[model samples]
Target chain A: MDFLTILNNSAAEILSPSTAAFALATIGLNVHFGYSGLLNFGQAAFMAVGAYAFAIFTMQVDPTATLGWPMWLSFVVAVLVAIVAAVAFALVLGIPTLRLRGDYLAIVTIAAAEIIRFTVRTSDYSAVTGGSQGLRGQDYKGDITGLNPLTGTTYGFGPWTGTAYDTWIRILAWTLVVVALILVWLLMRSPWGRVIKGIREDEDAVRSLGKNVYSYKMQALVLGGVLGGLAGIMYVLPRAVQPDNFATAMTFYIWTALLLGGAATVFGPLLGSILFWVLLAFTGGMLSGLQQIGAFGDMSGTQAGQLRFVLVGVALMLLVIFRPQGILGNKKELSFHV
Target chain B: MSETTTDGTAPTATHPLVDGEVAPGCKKVDPIVVADGVIRQFGGLTAVDVEHVEIPRGAITALIGPNGAGKTTFFNLLTGFDRPNKGSWSFEGQSLAHVPSHKVARRGMVRTFQLTKSLGRLTVLQNMLLGARDQRGESFFAALVRPLWRAQEQSNTEKADSLLARFKLDTKREDYAASLSGGQRKLLEMARALMSDPTLVMLDEPMAGVNPALTQSLLDHVKGLKDDGMTVLFVEHDMHMVRHISDWVIVMAEGRIVAEGPPETIMQNQAVVDAYLGAHHDTDLGTLTNQQVAQIHEAAEEEVPVGLEASATETTTTDAPAEPGATAHDEEGKR
Candidate 1:
């Protein structure tokens, strides 16, 4: 591919429906770990719920034949399932662990996410879920492709041009990101958001004021999880419903995005996600170009991919040690001694 | 007429005229809180174990005790900040024994911390806004409709600003709460408690660590709570503050109320005296009495020339008007 072609492909991936899903998920994580100081490590569970619920529902719409259910219905079902799963997960994890210190909750949530992933991976109902191999060839493009004005024709506005599917997913994904961002921004500015921050500072003081600190925390967790679920649905839209796709690494990536942008601010997650993807793409592209010219010195392509993670890890560690507040996070907010 | 009763138990009931003062206003009146057989034990220690206690409505009552006396624990229980091993109390006529702390605040009862608990990162105004938490502009749906939530948030902010002004903190309203002086923080905490429009306000050591220059303001602000028809319950170690302002005083020692009465009567009571200054001292309830605490405070005030007169006023109350220091020591020896 030419340099332009390479850049265009990278841009396409960054602006894809999948990227939108990750962005939204990271935003929700911002609410959890960023704003409220919750240590949720299983954000992917929320995604799994949304994606699996939508995919399973869509599949069930036709056991013998396609029920031809509208894609909008699937989206709505996905969101609702995500919300319910989030609330349930929050109650289960929150009740026993929220009252404990922060580290314990972090462990529980991470373990819980793993358990959820493994459970889905090993379940006997392999036919509906596609077992360990996972579901494949999902026709998510049917509705968007058909409705596109350029469904059967090439659409070009400038040097940039793409098929209807690519354009449609970008439009839908970005619209969701904007809406979720707005929602988070408004919610954080609300009185309820104040209580969550208060809970972060001092639960005793908040309680003394007659506010339910525990309940406020649970609500924040659920809200963030629901957003994560929306991201999950978006995550699997362009691809198949695969259990391995909802990996622990994905949650960690979301966290990386949140920290890179800012935790407390709504715009932090969006900016962080974009920066992360761009950096990853740049690193990958540089390594590949070097490999083609035998400029690796001794590094292999696989090693380069792993090296990208190592670089990201080092960046995160430095961020935590030197600037735990993240790029946009307030230093004062980071000092929650409680 | 009789110093000793027929049973020879030092008549436990009459000499102090102020004993009956807290009773008249409370006769046949409905109590806002009634704690019966409440007990809190930690390891081998009992933090609070009151058999019976009642908090009158629309009045400022002080819960006084020395260190380790469970005053904080009782405040915690009443506000649902902690769960007592055993105790049941009510707010208004409602049984608040099982109700959560936030629900307690929602039911028009709000409290401040003994140590100020302001969110440091947020501005003083933002902290104050957090206090007006029950305002109906927080729902997700309401948030989407900007006009409604925006108006409500504006009104809340305006109200918080007015409260800040009343507390003489208008100049620092935009500053971070952590940047505030100790006295200003005390003031901010009090002002924030009022943001919820609570009917009952509980202040835990509101005057602790406050400057003498601001003590009177804190006292007056507390008094103003009662004037505004809000019930005030506070935990304080300052007997003079309790005497000067409290309508009723409940003395706690080792987690139980040893005496309950008006300030004047409670101060002179043998039991109240024994709770303080220990059991071996003579009846020299003079400067060594409430005045000693004020005197310790006065010593701290000598550095500020501006508050010299206020400190003198505090001293003059402990001594004869003509000879402040001489009479103060003399009074300390004479009870």
Candidate 2:
């Protein structure tokens, strides 16, 4: 077995740009479910809107199919459009569902995410969205790669080496994560943050104090959604824009990362995302090596691939059963009304 | 005391309802809160059904009744915590029928929950800070920029600190509310209510789970509210407390007002006595054995004298019932 390669791959996954993207998304989840006690299961929908909006704005396509905007302007426009789309999505979902408590929001949000995924996959909008095949990396990779200051350099030693373009994306993604963390830290310490925490504990108590509970919840939803949109943009930076990437499972994975670290804590998502990806990569490598060596009598390569997720599921269940507060969350802070 | 005012306004006469009076719908001379046809129901059960009731302005009014008498429900409806089936109530002069609980508090009428709704996860100081009115820091944009609300926050903290000292909870300022004792939580709730500077403070069972040591202090703090020219309306089951501090008493039974009078007379009223002992009224004395009869007599003798003394002292004194009560009234009158 190539144990050395496995270790290197796992290390790379931990520091990869995708890990940064997931960390940012989970941070937004922390704001929604952790601090505010809002049950938002459609984080994937926000990410999808952000990714698609950014891709569409920046892509050079037929005049009828796309905007064909300038690359730099498109980058700014894409981010703005993604945030606005997320807010619009929050309004459409939040206005009606925020009034209802708990499971209603969960059901509506999960359903909304599925709807977004399916809508993008349909042939009806294939002209702009590229349908099921989705827009490939070639569409906007040149523009994104062109912005990298390090034109022809390679970083890191041995197996850890990354192209200048990859390095640029990683820097940008991690920088976004840092910015999101600082903003969230400032927010949670403020009076507004206290109100959100109060709502999570007991909304009625907050209402009795003359603070508008609904308005606070809506603000939390929009803030979290905007962050999710940014995460979506970060996610697409290193790869192609695929509708499948924004599926319901993507949200669950983000939730898993959030819960794995610590739901309400600032550092929880960052650590959780890194650990999750690293574990997945390490397990995948070990399992594939074992299968190639005929470790299993009848289990095929595909079965081994599926078994890796099963192991992850088991790990998640154990985590919930024993340490429900997650790695960094305080047991006291986790006593939410939901 | 019964002399009518010549100013063409409602009479400010004391004890409008005579001793042992059973008024179906009592009206105050200058009512601070007026309710008409207020009814609340939970499925088939009618929780509160007040046809007409007026709470006297600037007086300590006690709403007393047996269990399930709907005292808390009435408080809920008046404070806009719960909606009434069909009713309208006004605070000061504005109608509060459709006003929300937060707006009711903003309009100078605040209430505490019977179960004590202190934000448990928050610090005592933070809880007190939350009670401050119209905080700029509470806004979304203002919260991000501390300078916008830093001065207001400092002032609010000062106010909260003073209130905490007044409530004797200054030592536990940084402690989480959940870590506090039951009685301390009650104190925290009352102290928090004062941060609003409310005109009318409605306390729901402020002494429900409190120890005797804290109960006396809570009683004094409530009396202090009246001394500061704030109208105090409280829901209480402790007859001794109701008799000791209440200027006027309104008693409810089976979701309707059965008696209204000064504290001294409310105990002697037939409607109230029946409301309390009505379940045993139909019991046959002949059916009970001699031992059981003696036990019943012993129980009555022990309880009846305290009630009698409470009523007697309350009715005879035109100034105030107890020494503390007298001083409280004087202080209020001075204010």
lDDT (tens digit, per residue) of candidate 2 on B196-232: 8999999899889999988899999999999999999
Instruction: Predict model 1's lDDT versus the native.
Output: 0.76
Error of 1 at B238 (Å): 3.4
lDDT of 1 at B29: 51
Cα lDDT of model 2 overall? 0.85
Error of 2 at A104 (Å): 2.2
Candidate 1: residue A335 lDDT (0-100):
54
Model 2 residue B104 CA deviation (Å) reads 1.6
Top candidate on TM-score is 2
Cα deviation at B291, candidate 2, in Å, is 23
Evaluate every candidate with DockQ and list the scores. Answer: 0.32, 0.31
After superposition, candidate 1 runs with Cα above 4 Å error: A1-13, A63-79, A95-104, A139-149, A153-161, A291-296, A321-323, A330-338, B1-31, B277-335
On lDDT, the candidate that comes out on top is 2
